[model samples]
Target: MPLLESLVKRRKNREPLSYITGKAEFFKRQFSVDERVLIPRPESEQLVAQTINYVRKLGIEHPRIADIGTGSGAIAISIALEMPSAEVFATDISSEALKVAQMNAHKLGAEVEFTQGNLMGTLQGKFDLIVSNPPYIQSQVIKSLEPEVLREPRIALDGGPNGTEVISPLLEEIRKKLKPSYSAAYVEIDPPIADIALKTAQAKFSYAEVSILTDLAGLIRCISIENN
Candidate 1:
């Protein structure tokens, strides 16, 4: 068919299929995606699962959650839909990405407040749970990445020279934003930065529990900070 031929041509040209189709699935739900937003990945589902489990484990009746760099609003929207009583807020620096996220939230009927700002800087008050999938890929590595990946927004993938550019500051900021107790934060990271993440979190939360969580493929993918 003409559509199939066009899709094949796009694939051959290294254009991400998700962008070509304008859709990407996340947390078992289909989300509208375009070049403006990075496509959601399965690894991020672990971030969402861990966040939800943390809330249920603590038995928080009304938890305040924040999702930074919420590209497609997948994590925030999914959490809001799962825990209807919880207050969920998502932030992104890109207005275009936020537009896609807001559209998805409206389409899914997920009650998530989307804000435009830098990371968690826009959020006020302490949160019971905070989660983010900040850009963790090293700047140099990004240039050598697959062509399909290079097509994604650079701001959503580049983590500066050392790859901890966003994460380091985020950990520092999270300590101030999270509740003193019974609060936690989950952040996705590249495998190479696992040690750096652990070190940063340990330094930030001396008394809190810090651990690295692995994805289904057994790759270190998330840094978990529990302010117990």
Candidate 2:
């Protein structure tokens, strides 16, 4: 009864349920979470599954993977836990967020190297798989989101004027660095701007097979890239 009351109080105050609970479940594992890091969403789990399958198809027994803007190390750690043979690394500009991610990694016993840098700039190698759930919410619509969402860090949500600002440039860098033929990049995108994701990826990775993957709701949720 006390737990239920506390949850009700949190929702009434607009504190995110995940924040109040101090954890979130992703890819079937409990990950410590707080305001310091963006709460992992079920939608992002698809990025992990997609990446695993795509890389496996490439026959990479020990693939290298980088999760850009790894807020709570949910995606990166989850991938690491599942693909024991794979090498996983995560990057985040926020030192606080990195700390939270590191704690979760340690608690979950997943070995994911964390780096402090914006996007993929800090990463040093051409990974067999690169993935991200970059900030894709347009500035104008930020305040219009649910009060619970507003409580999360804006840096993890604001995607600039059109919601694809971060994604565009990130794709550009990935285009130049993705290992030819055997490498791929997966990006979680806003449904409304799925077209922008596809266009940017196609423009940057002209020779890659870029596809818009839909979530269970039948809404476009991710962009998958494979070097052709």
Candidate 3:
């Protein structure tokens, strides 16, 4: 009963239940999470599902996959576990977040290579699939977030003046890192920025198939760019 009271006290303080429990479920698996990382969301699981579906559809026996801004290793580990034949790599700018990601990967027994870097800047070679759930929240709006969300690491939320700060640079870098043929990138974004995200993706990959994907709620949630 005392422990329950302590949990209730933490909840009253607006701390995320995931943080208090030290775990968050994603893609039907549990991942370790804390203040150092953003809790994995359901929308990101859709991103992973799409990636896996694409890889299977392409019939790639051994695809090279990269997950950027891999908070808590949710997306990376999920993909790695589902598609064990694929070579999975995950990157994050924060070493602290990477530690959480690494721990999750280790605990989940998912074979993922975790690296500390900004987006895809540190990854080498081309990837068959590039996925990211980056910081797309407007910097000014972050302060207005719910208390539980505010407790998440600020660096994992701030996206400069506009919501596309990190998304813009990430798309720019992907052009060089993504395979020229039979490759795609899936980036999660807030619904409000769907138009901007679509435009940015189309501008970056004019010859490729660029489109906005909606989540279960029918709200725009991801921008998908497929190379021809």
**All predictions: root-mean-square deviation over Cα?**
1.0, 1.6, 1.0
In order, what lDDT does every prediction score?
Answer: 0.93, 0.90, 0.92
Assess candidate 1 and give its lDDT: 0.93
State TM-scores per candidate. 0.97, 0.95, 0.97
Off by over 4 Å in 2: 1-8
| Candidate 3 structure quality by residue, lDDT tens digits, 170-212 | 9999888999999999999988778888898899899899998
Ranking by TM-score: 3, 1, 2
Question: Over 4 Å off in model 1, which ranges?
Answer: 1-4
Task: Enumerate residue pairs that collide in model 1.
Answer: none
Candidate 1 to truth, TM: 0.97
By lDDT, the better pick of 1 and 2 is 1
38-77, model 2: which lDDT tens digit per residue?
Answer: 9999999999999888877777899989999999999999
Candidates 2 and 3, the one with greater lDDT:
3
Candidate 3 TM-score, true structure as reference: 0.97
Measured by lDDT, the strongest candidate is 1
